[model samples]
Target: MRIIISPAKKMRVDTDTLAWHDLPCMIDRAEVLYDKLASMSYDELKRLWKCNDAIAALNVERLHNSDLRIRLTPAILSYEGIQYQYMAPGVFTDEQLIYVQEHLRILSGLYGVVRPFDGVTPYRLEMQAKLPIEGAKDLYGFWGSAIADQLYQETDCIINLASKEYSVCVSRHQKPGTRFITCVFGEEKDGKVVEKGTLCKMARGEMVRYLAEANAKSPEAMKDFACLNYVFSPAHSDESTYVFLQKKSQDSEE
Candidate 1:
């Protein structure tokens, strides 16, 4: 069993070596996207969505375990202008937060707001939750109820459950304005290996299909599992959809 926490070569936010203009430009880019989407026609919006999806796939290529299933949408605004909407990893709760903190207390990196320099940490209040063995329905219920009230405007990102017992994770790190992918793999325990894989390119419609399969009572292929993985399903990119995992690799003999 081997556990590895490998940093993405090009994360959503690579702060340590960041240039002075990086953060500002990144923020501006998000807002600019908001503005562009502010008045986008229906057809134009659809085009934008497809383009964003393509970009997400391209970005995922640089990292071993980043979420390729994440989505970027033309974020509608209230009194303001248009913004970006991240459909995946969208919901949260406080109990989930506490549980995440407790679970990641040992790993430390899994809890807390990413430091100013931790560009890769993405959104503030990044935390990890363990998948309850009870069942998927019960798990989401606990999570939705837990963070529903507490995660009002302050909270940013959440790292859902990973399949490996007590040793792995799949996350979505919120970026400055809108977000696409901010992923991480936490500590690995003995005899466990987190295998790295990804779904290179996908469309929103395709993602929806994969999600359906992933969440089925049982998935036949990694693609089906990818869709079901969600923000907290304890899984990553798969071909049926998009699922990445940090698991202990078995020998060829196995």
Candidate 2:
């Protein structure tokens, strides 16, 4: 089994972390996109990133100076989003880290798909970015089946923890034999499963940690995940979707 999660926009370049690995498998492909991004003017970049003055300037600078092959941080240590914060991969034991390396995959606009230990640099591309490259209409078109092909090379069962944007790239191109299961984290509100943004992110992160610690080998193992008061609801789940819900009050306090 393998798990796929979304890459975060909030990133940091930390040299303090000793764990590092070679560049992502699609580094060459990333360089091609980098070149396209680099050719755009600052104003164009601002438009591409859809950011404020500060963020746009920072990313423009990053695009100007960043090298895919040079300065790098482990993908696990780089992302600082709410999901990554909850996962707290830095606190994981060596065995858990190994499990993550073998089982987790990060969906990225820049790198396509990243392993936990893959070396990465700071960038500001989202999967939904509108940058039309070569003959392709957008990032999704440029990626096509490459991401799914890579995941299929790794494992047949994919536990998708990524958001819809990144997840579509995989779901659309899944191999015939692939088993894709999506875990839904939410609260049962008025008898309906309601997914709030922050709670869902927290649950997704905690679920990753749970999987790593338990060395989960199948989707059925995920039903045992009880982090942050989330409990599996079989009645709300189907064959391809697993629903884990917390109480409304329990989510509000967090």
Candidate 3:
């Protein structure tokens, strides 16, 4: 099974941690995107990124100077978001690292889909960003079925840990017969399942680590995940969705 996750908006360059094994599969396409972004003015890019001036300025500098092919960090190590922090791939054992290298795929707006150890430079673009390319209306349209098609080629079963923005790129164009399962981390609120953004990110990261350690080979194996006070809810889960609800703490129970 291939596991899919989203790219974090926050990133850093860490060429010293672990060497990148390969360039992203869609490097040529990424170059096309890079050139487009590189050509845009700082103000234009700032609007596209939808960020504060400081962030926009930083990325504008990165776009101008950072070479995508040179001095790259592994995709897993580059992202500095909470999810990556919890995944903590930097401390993984050789076996666990190997497992993730084989199964983990990071979905990116600029790179389409990248392997865990794929070489990448820090850049700012979100899957939902409205940067029109060629004849496509948005990044999603630009990616088309490319992400799903590539994932289908790797495995018939895909375990989606990505947020909806990135996951939609694959879900909308999955090949027939492919089994796509989404893992939801949430709490039971007012007798309904409610997912909060930060908690879900933490859970997703923890789940990646759990799967790597377990060397999970099947979707059924995922049901065994227990972390961050979450337990699988059979009542809320179906074939395509696995819902894990947070259990109240002892203090709260008292």
Candidate 4:
């Protein structure tokens, strides 16, 4: 099974902790995107990035000076979002790290898809950003079915730990007979599963850690995941989605 997750917006360069095993598979495509972004003026790029002057300037500088091939951090270590922070790959055992390297795939706006150990540089493009490239209207159109196609080449089953923005790129273009299971971490409120953004990110990250440590190999294996107070709710889950509800604490229940 392949675990698909989203890339973090916040990133850093950490070349000392772990050596990247290889460059991203889509480096050529990333270079194409890099060239496109490089060609845009500061004002255009700032608008495209939808950030404040400070963030835009930082990213513009990153684009200008960064090389995709050099001084790269492992894709797993580069991201600094809550999800990655909670996953905490830096503390993982060697075997756990190997499990993740084999199973995890990160979806990116600039790079299409990357493995855990794939070398990557920091960049600011998001999948939903409106950058029309080579006649494609947006990143989704630009990526088309390529991402899903590559995932299929690896396995027939996919465990989606990514948010909708990145997961949609895979879900929308799934091939025939693929078992795409989405794990939903939320709470039952007013007869509905309500997903809190920050909590969900934490759960998603923890879930990846759980899977890696367990060396999970099947969809049924995922139902056993019980990290960060999330318990699988079979009543709410269906064939395509596995729902996990956060159990109320003793203090909260009082």
**Arranged by lDDT, best first:** 4, 3, 2, 1
**Per-residue lDDT over 76-146 for candidate 3, one digit per residue giving the tens place of the 0 to 100 score:** 99998989989999899999999999999999999999998999999999999999999998998889999
lDDT per residue for candidate 4 within 76-193, as digits (tens), equals 9999999999999999999999999999999999999899999999999999999999999999998999899989999999999999999999999888998999999999999999
Q: Write down the worst ten-residue block by lDDT for model 2.
A: 245-254
Deviation (Å) of 118 in candidate 1: 17
**What TM-score fits each model?**
0.19, 0.96, 0.98, 0.98
Residue 111 C-alpha lDDT in model 4: 95
Residue range 122-220, candidate 1, lDDT tens digits: 211112223222243322322332222222133332222122211223222123442122222222346342433332112221232333333322222
Q: Alpha-carbon error at 94 in model 2, in Å?
A: 0.6
Greater lDDT among 1 and 3 belongs to 3
Q: Against the true structure, what is every candidate's RMSD?
A: 19.4, 2.1, 0.8, 0.7
lDDT values for all models: 0.25, 0.91, 0.93, 0.94
Specify the highest-lDDT model's number.
4
Q: What is the overall TM-score of model 3 with all chains considered together?
A: 0.98
RMSD of 2: 2.1
Off by over 4 Å in 3: none
Residue 204 shift from truth in candidate 1, angstroms: 22
lDDT of 2 by residue, 107-220 (tens): 999999999999999999999999999799899999999999999998889999999999999899888867999999988778888898888889999999999989888989
Q: lDDT at 229 for candidate 4?
A: 91
